[model samples]
Target: MIEFWISAGLLCLIAMGFLLLPSLRRNRARAEEDRTAVNVALYEERVQALEEQHQAGVLDEPGLQTAQDEAARELLADTDGDAGRQRVRGRVVPMLAAVCVPVLGLLLYAKFGAIGAVEQARTAAEAPGTIEQITARLERAVRERPESSQGWYFLGRTLIAEGRAADAAKAFQRAAETGGRAPAVLGLWAQALYFAGDKQWSPQLDALTDEALAADPSEASTLGLLGIHAFDERRYADAIGFWEKLLAIMPAGEPSRQGIERSIAMAKAQMDQRSNAQDAPTPAKGIRLRVALADALQQQVRPNDAVFVFARAVDGPPMPLAVKRLRVADLPAEVSLSDTDAMMPELTLSAFEKVELVARISRAGDAQHGEWIGREQGAPRAEQALREVVIDALDKGASGNER
Candidate 1:
């Protein structure tokens, strides 16, 4: 937040500085143009007067010569003097302003802002989640209890993990029916619907959320759904209200709190975008996936090492996403997954429809899991899907579905 202000203030100062220098330079140029025109006219008039005097026999050759020399010398002195003075003035102000603007911006940011903390928060936001460990546990849990709705929920989450939006939506639907409509179920359903880009199903999502909200007003998931719906519909005030309610319910440093804060920022940004239609600015639309090793789990590898990161078309053959390989020792304890990573080709919120991410710590070592960081459950849906595939494979092998 503080960084935003500092950046905003710096940008304003830059714009102001640009405006000031150009206007001043224009004024100075106009002044020089005016002076040059006046000086030329004076010289022409003096020469005409000299010609008239000579024609009227009012002056001798020497007098005319002396008058011409005086006029030319005067013109040279005046023009040079004015040019030097304007040059000195013009060069000085812009240079002084250039130095002062950024300095002033720094001082203002230091005195009245939260730039450092905001940057730290932003950095935290960029860190990758420990999804693999969670996915592993969720996978284990669902295997242990195949009939549990918790397992279904976990499976839906894994479908989401694999970027299988449509499948995740179906799984979430099942989870909701089995659990009698949990807030998490409703939230995930709504998110899946939203990501699927089908407006026709939104009314159902809205109804589900209404019921969920009635059951628990402080439910962060439902509140998030409301906020998202409001944001999507351009109801900024409503969205802000919902997000604020969510923030009030959540303690600082919680995931819900951070998510709500991001929503608020995005909501306000959308508001600003609407207000500035003439500007035609576009927000960043990109996604990044980073893979890293846990420090506590690392036996011999350095924490700062780089790791391989890749992505593929969710529905196609495992084509690698464009990225460079870095050693596992180059990255911090947490890796950042973002669009800027070279591995992300055509990165956008909608680009990933279904993808399998594999991160190997080493050829022989166990790869860190994805899909379990914030999600407490393993992917039950994935396990079920795997089972179905296995059965299908067996049936194909047997040439029929008959047991």
Candidate 2:
């Protein structure tokens, strides 16, 4: 910011020089004109005396001619070879303009220029470039602004990138304490804690991931962490389920897509191998439900509208345990909610003994809120018989149905 102001001051000086130079030259020219006028007045007086002597007959024609010639010689010798001068112009206008130019420029700039943005840009350009330098800067920043959530958050992210997960966890904790506990922040905090614990699963880490997913089911970091945990535990099917959801929400052409896809394929291969083994575990049966829009609310929905069917634990986090998406046209559709449809690996349908089944119709395709919704009033066993969920009511701030 200081450098920017110094450069701007220099440019202003250059501009002032342009405005004042011509005025300075004009003042010098006026002084020269005044000297010329003095010389002309002296010459005219000498010529007038010569003419008076001739008229008085004190000099004959030849004598007067010699005198006039001598006077002309003296006049020419005194004046030298200089151009005739014009009347001097007033200096007030030019001087006033020279003074006003810089002042007016400053005033206009103050009114219209993006001075704050310029300062911000300069600050950003001069920011620490290397990871170590940035980490140091962020550490200092957090210390100075202890209540700044953004500072703490970035510090945590930098620490994580610098391979200091324990320090990162503390930083993330500070960030959350400073009111930066958004889903992304929570996910990153959980990730840092998980890695700092040598990838060990703990109740605290589980709660963090669950809290993040409760806020936003599609939080990428939490989903990725869960998938990695499941895969490491040899829960290949669960890992595949988690990674598939992660893969679906990831933007196309992402640089990390290939790595995630490879992981998914590996998990699937492992699952296939385990299924072919003689000691394979039987797959757990999940709840089955038939969903259909009520006749009264049918006109309020479109064929292309999204339909979400899911189950959530009766007394657990708000995030869905298992979810399946379909279009309104697919209803009266039959869908199954199982571990394979789990939103997160650890939060599968079978993990909870009793769960509530819900169906919703959303025109905007958001699973959290919908125009019409239906659900079973009582919690049922995970392996309950196939049931029908009629989309019969308006979803007006409905509880326990949020994704």
Candidate 3:
């Protein structure tokens, strides 16, 4: 900045030099004009003296005429152009200008020029190699001119890039205020405030974002922030709903399209999982398995015995994620355990990373305790081909207790 001012002062001096130097130095044209004026004055004085001498009888008419002719010749020799024309005068104006021009320039700059802005611009041009320096300049600019909403907005963005959400929120707020609560500005301000509060939602932020969306329903940032917040709070349906709205408004080939799509997919999976937990058995969103009694166990199994086909988390509470019931007579049948078939309101196939399938034949028809069971364990996924669960093992206590 100092270097900038130094250069600026030097340039001003150089310009003033150009403007004032010619006035101080004598030029050929002015010298000729001066010489012509001097010669004309001398010629008039000599001609008057010769006429006085002739009138006093000290010189004849011819002498007076000869002296007058000599004076005219001298005048002609000294002058270049018409002798009647007047020469421009007064060094006072140029001298005054030379003396007062720099002062006047300084006064004008003090009144209307942006000294700080000029210095900042000059310094940036001279040394803009670091982000910190650039950011500092931006900060100073916005601070100096609070009404510069665009400048403030960019400063806020830079602050966010610097991971200063708290500071960025302040800048964004200023920008929104200065920028007349513009939709994008307000939405971004809300986002910055949200992060500054450690991702906690506030009524103020909610109001801000709502207002922004009201102004522009297709505002992507507000929708995206809302969706992300919902997803983080496990409100998958709300998350999906918000993201779906954003998706509808997003342009084709949007740079953020993939991220939003992934979020939407995950939210949908969570929503489907929750929905399945509270619904009835349906394979539309579940896994399918074929339960069959082994040929050797066929003779031991009773046709009227209850057969329970279910899926449970591999390492979770001892509750079925989904379950189906049938009779032993229905052996070699395909059964489905899905979100709709969840045994509890909080358990579903999609919620668990892994689950085991079991086909149990219970003589007493108790779900918790079974006589003989066939088991298959792996990741639970909706598959067209049925996974086989054959009842082949003897009940550890069923036959023993019967005996």
Clashes (N, CA, C under 3 Å) per candidate: 32, 0, 2
lDDT of 2 by residue, 368-389 (tens): 8888889875466644588779
Q: Considering every candidate listed, which one attains the maximal TM-score? A: 3
**Which segments of candidate 1 are over 4 A away from where they belong?**
1-146, 198-201, 272-403
List TM-score per model, in order.
Answer: 0.33, 0.41, 0.50
Q: Tens-digit lDDT track for model 3 on 1-403?
A: 5775688678878997787667555553576668777887888899889988998999998888888898898788667444323233335556677668778877898899888777656655776666676689888787677799998999988898888988888988888888898988887888888888999999998899889889999898899899989999999888988999999988898999899999999988888888888795643467778888888887787889998888887767666788888999887898877788887877777887677787778999986667787878666465446788998885564321222
Residue lDDT tens for model 1, 81-140: 889988898888878877787778779878998755565456546544677655555555
Lowest lDDT 10-residue stretch of candidate 2:
81-90
Q: Rank the candidates by lDDT, best first.
A: 2, 3, 1
Worst-scoring 10-residue span by lDDT in model 1:
387-396
lDDT of 1: 0.62
Superposed model 3: Cα runs more than 4 Å off = 1-99, 123-131, 272-403
TM-score of 3: 0.50
